[model samples]
Target chain A: MIEALKQRLSEHFQLTNLTIKNAGLAFLWVEKHELEMLLRQLRDFEGYTHLSFIIASDHIEKNQFKLTYMLHNYDTKHDLGVHVDISRVNASMHSIHPLWAQAWTYQRELKEMYGIDFPESPRVDEDFCLEGWDDMPPMRRDFDTVKYCEEHFDDRDGRATEENRQTMKVNIYPERGE
Target chain B: MNLTHDFSPTPEVDLASGKYVKIWHGPQHPGITGNMSLELTLCGDEIVNCKTHVGYLHRGFEKLMERRTYIQNFPLVCRIAVPEPTFNEYLYSAGIEDLAGIEVPELAKWLRCLNLELMRLGSFLMWLGGASGAFGMSTVYQWTVTHRDYILDLFEEMTGARIYHMYISPGGVRAPLPDGFKDRCLMVMKKVEKLLYEVETTVLNNAVFKKRAIGLGVISSDMVDAYGVTGPNQRAAGYARDTRKDSPYLVYEQLDFDVITATGSDAFDRTIVRYQEMHQCVSLIRQMLDRMPTDGAFHTPTPNVLHWKIPAGETYVKAECTRGEYGYYIETDGSEYVRRVHIRGPSYTHAIAVMEKLVIGANIADVAGLMVSLHTYPPEIER
Candidate 1:
């Protein structure tokens, strides 16, 4: 079923890197510009109407972020993921809020967490999760959460230093040798 | 598909006009489902605009999972949804298993299904209590909560934890059924069945529940796909889309059941759909216990937990949670830690976009009832 859809999709759109994870799931990459049309076609013609989610993965070394839009077809019980990569330097993508009412929330969250821009999305600039967050987007691969926690949070007097559980157990029970 | 939804611009409301009053509905109120607030703009007891406010309980689980290994994430995923954690554990483990190409044992499959069904019953019980409590029927709340405690007792004996049962781990489950667990579970089921009957008489058949719930927060059929509604919310709208039936995972294909649905798509219909599903859960649990193998290995050995690295791949595994389609999207980088993990809880859409739209033109008194009908857990939304 996915192969037939891929065949139909590749006929018109510039499709690349088709990866079938299983019989019921598949993922394919498309140009950022072709995403809106492709998604409309998928929803209207191919019956992949339910938008499951939109998620971003930061590939710091590649200087790009992979955004996956997961769509589900209830009739076929198949999940087709549309992947689009945008440069991490000025990450922006076309908003699909016009297609799905819930897309704006996902776009808003992506904007807040990954610093990705979804132009004209409703409340895209508003804080979706974090309030008064002055640091870099926390979900980005570059964000060092451990360092931030250590810097912002104070350690208790007796628990200033952290120890590995295995090593601590060995130190507390020296009679039981490994 | 036709793009018929009119994305009409929301009319600006002037708070200075003195005709309107703005109020915060949640974050501390018992009427709210969890620690989430709704900013409502009302005009004489009628809501004109509603905006959902979250992040009160955000633990940043997605970011935290990136620093933890595959095995370490098993226990952490359960915290995403407090009411029903087995779906999280199952989906997280299933996503890992899918990417790592590990086939689970048959005994573990039955056990996972049993755990999920039981979790669904317990979660529905809690929602039943909350739904009734929201409508001023506190008696049903006490009855359902006590029955839910009985289910928790079953969980305590089986998984050694009442709330967060990290029994379903990567590769397979952690243990098998305990001795005489079937009889005790059946006894609890019988008691729950009796409790549900009493609820049907005192709550579902009550005059107040029908008056307040019927024709309230009605979601049209077209909105189901547009807003990404699923489970009972979609089922109540007359769309028989169930993750268990649509894409059967584990032992669901072998289980005999029908997709329960209704046409009203209101708070009352959703409650009825869920109420019927609770009975289905009882049946599924009984079937699983009767057919599961008595002696077999439940756990499948995997690579060392301290240093488990999965090949680079991405997969989205979802299951029919009590609320809706709960899923986990995992991306591995052939490292000890995950590259990216996204927990997709149904509440993310239901509590935010859907609730924001449905609350418009609704009475302030019905806001809590409408929210409870959707059965959202705020922790999952911010996780």
Candidate 2:
């Protein structure tokens, strides 16, 4: 399995650092350029038909967000975990949706939740997060959850007020039906 | 050969004729189960068409899990499959354990099976509650819910939380079974058997239930595959697929129990599949208790998960839930949190794709019954 993935990935793109990880279910590496070609090979060649899930995390101190591709093999009962890091500065990626149909909602969700840009995705209009809003993506490691709670969260049943009175107070906060 | 597929929009009927009636089963219908709306177009005693609407109970749990820690998501995973929360915990823990190279002790594995089977029994009882109510058998619904409480109380005693017991850690269980847990198991199994008799006479044998369920929402083996329906619904259709038997995880392989199935492939068969499976769960739990060793480490010693960073890896763990095979695909990048978690809930294939396509022009009256009979859980769908 390791040799197969290594050869398959190496055939498409030059791999820098490849390691068999997560129970040897996948060949993990930091692919420099031909990301699309490698993903295409994963989809068409290896029959890793399912795009299991994609997760993006911010390495705030490092100024980079790690984007991981969790891939599933249809024929084999093994999962392929792929990791790639895109600079937090750009927050963009060439969409992998052309290879997997299910990646649409997940990528769109990434845009909403993490404010990452999928530059090549044509159908990026769907709103996955805050409507009529202005704020950093909530999923970003930099996004302060406590501050967001302080700003938008209501002290329903006087709970937040009583709890936060020991910490912070909201002077004039408009509330609605919870 | 009665495959429904006329996706024309339904129009409201005029009430002035006195023959046409409009009923809003919705965002608040007991039969609808979750917060879902099914606008039924009825022409008095018969349904013309039905339109299903979602978005009432959308919690964006998948989105929420991304925000919380791996351990914190344990409590939240329960909310995904409300009726069978432990199934979610089991899958998630198993996935992490598989990835983290954690080997739980033998006794702990048996206890896992005990908790799993108990959860299945509890969930099946809840399904009986909903399925019975869907068919207008109120007594069965009431009796089943009241009786299932004992199982939930047992869960509460074991894990503090009655409904969402975040007890199944990735390493193993939160703790070993409480003292006299084996006696408690025996007590529950005996009680469940007696209650099973009461249920058989009062509900399962009820003529009205039999008539309504035997023919309504009938499906076939081909239909099961086409619709991707599994669990009791598929077993009721005579399929040989079951994670317990086929891909036995945890301590299921050693446990002695039959994969209860039926050939009718109708509402009655599906209900029976669940009913008998509850008994099988009892039998399985009893068998597990007998075979279970008295002592072993309940949890594998792993790096304190609070401070633990998963080695960059991925693992897909699959388990048999009350419904069917529950698959969890997890990816971690040597972090305190998971990279991403995608749940391949069998219900997604059954509820939305299958239910939507199958219930197109069926009797609107049978729509709610059909949904419950299908064992559709909306969180699994929406997640």
Candidate 3:
């Protein structure tokens, strides 16, 4: 199945990298410029009809955001992950909502959560998974969730702090000496 | 059926202007199953457009899982899907085990299957009540919920809690089966199976239910492929796309079962599809009880969860959740904390994309019924 996918993708574009992560799971790192064409072939010609999900992971150390478009085929029950690296400074990608209607919801979520831009998505400008507030996209790696929680919400009064909690863990389940 | 009707509210212009009145249909009403709203634009009794609004139940679970240790994530993921909580736990545990290179024991595999099947039965019972009640059959709700509590009693005995069972964990299950647990579970399941006949007569065979659900919210196989509608919704459309059958997870490959499908592809067909699945769950549990080894290792040993660390890797584990496919894409950075955890719940597509398309041109009275038939749990969508 992996060989078949590789042969099929090679027909459309130059296959730069194809890594088989696990049995029935494979990943292809495509150029950010060729993502739309790659996904179009995967959906149309490669029998990858189901757009399972779209998720972005912020790799701040490399100054890149990894966007994965996960697709599944109904006949073979195989999964393929198409990974694209976008510049963290200006994260923008073409929307595949025209290919999969479900992409509208996922693209809207990515736009709101990671502040990524999908230029042509329907309802991409509307509020998604969050409400009216002016703040940084919370899912980014540098969003400082603990600090935001402390400022916005009140903590429980009787809970132990981090240091005390570590001590309590040792006291409760002491390690056994062999 | 009359598609247009007179409203008591005064109209500002004649019918030629193409003006429609908008109404908020949810966020508080019993017609909605969860904390979600649908903004419906209605011309008389026919709906012209609908926009779904969620995020009322968003708890930022994805971020919270990243902050907490892998062990602490067990309970949090279960809360993502309220009705059938064990599927979330199962996927998270399986994903972490895959990343950390932990092999689940054979006895634990059967135990986990038992737990998942029981959860499916419980969720279908709740759906039976909600689907019937949507069409003004309140008695079926009373009957089905009462029988569902028996399953909850079994859950309370096996795991300490009824709704959220933090029993399934990374290495294996949290604890072994209690003494005589199988017998007690079988007893409850038998009683539930007997009562299913009554449910069939009251809900599936009821004339009113048939009239209300026969052709409502009809979904085609083409629509299922395009929008990714799954589980009972797709099965009712005559496509046997079950994850258990397609990608055999756990001991499901070893066990014998059948995929239930119907031909109607309408609201009534979906109801009947789930109504028939209860029998499969019962027989599957019976097979588990007979085939499982009595005195075998139930859980694998692991490092203390508080200090456990997974190696740097990423894996996706999926299972047949009650609603549809439940998947977890877990990544670890070789640290005590998880790097990323993205949940691809079935409701994400069922609630937003499929519901948006199905709601347009539907009668206002059948809108709630259509939503109920899709079985979209809202928290999974917003989370």
The number of the candidate with the highest TM-score is: 1
Error at B125, model 2, angstroms: 0.9
Q: Which stretches of candidate 2 lie over 4 Å from their true place?
A: A1-152, A155-178, B1-24, B39-51, B219-227
lDDT of 1 by residue, B231-320 (tens): 899999999889998899999999999999999999999999999999999999999999999988898888766557899999999999
- Collision pairs in model 2: A22-B313
lDDT of prediction 3: 0.85
Q: Which of candidates 1 and 2 is the stronger one according to DockQ?
A: 1
Each candidate's TM vs. the true structure?
A: 0.97, 0.73, 0.94
lDDT of 3 by residue, B290-329 (tens): 8887777878898877778899977777888878888998
Q: Which candidate should be chosen as best, given DockQ against the real structure?
A: 1
Task: Give the Å error, residue B375, model 3.
Answer: 0.5
Instruction: Look at candidate 1 and tell me the lDDT of residue A133.
Output: 88
**What CA root-mean-square deviation does each model show from the true structure?**
2.0, 7.7, 4.7
Highest lDDT against the true fold, candidate: 1
- Candidate 3 chain A weakest ten by summed lDDT: A169-178
The Cα local distance difference test for each model comes to 0.91, 0.71, 0.85
Tens-place lDDT digits, model 3, residues A14-94: 667887877678878888888888887777777888878899998899999988888888888888888888998878889
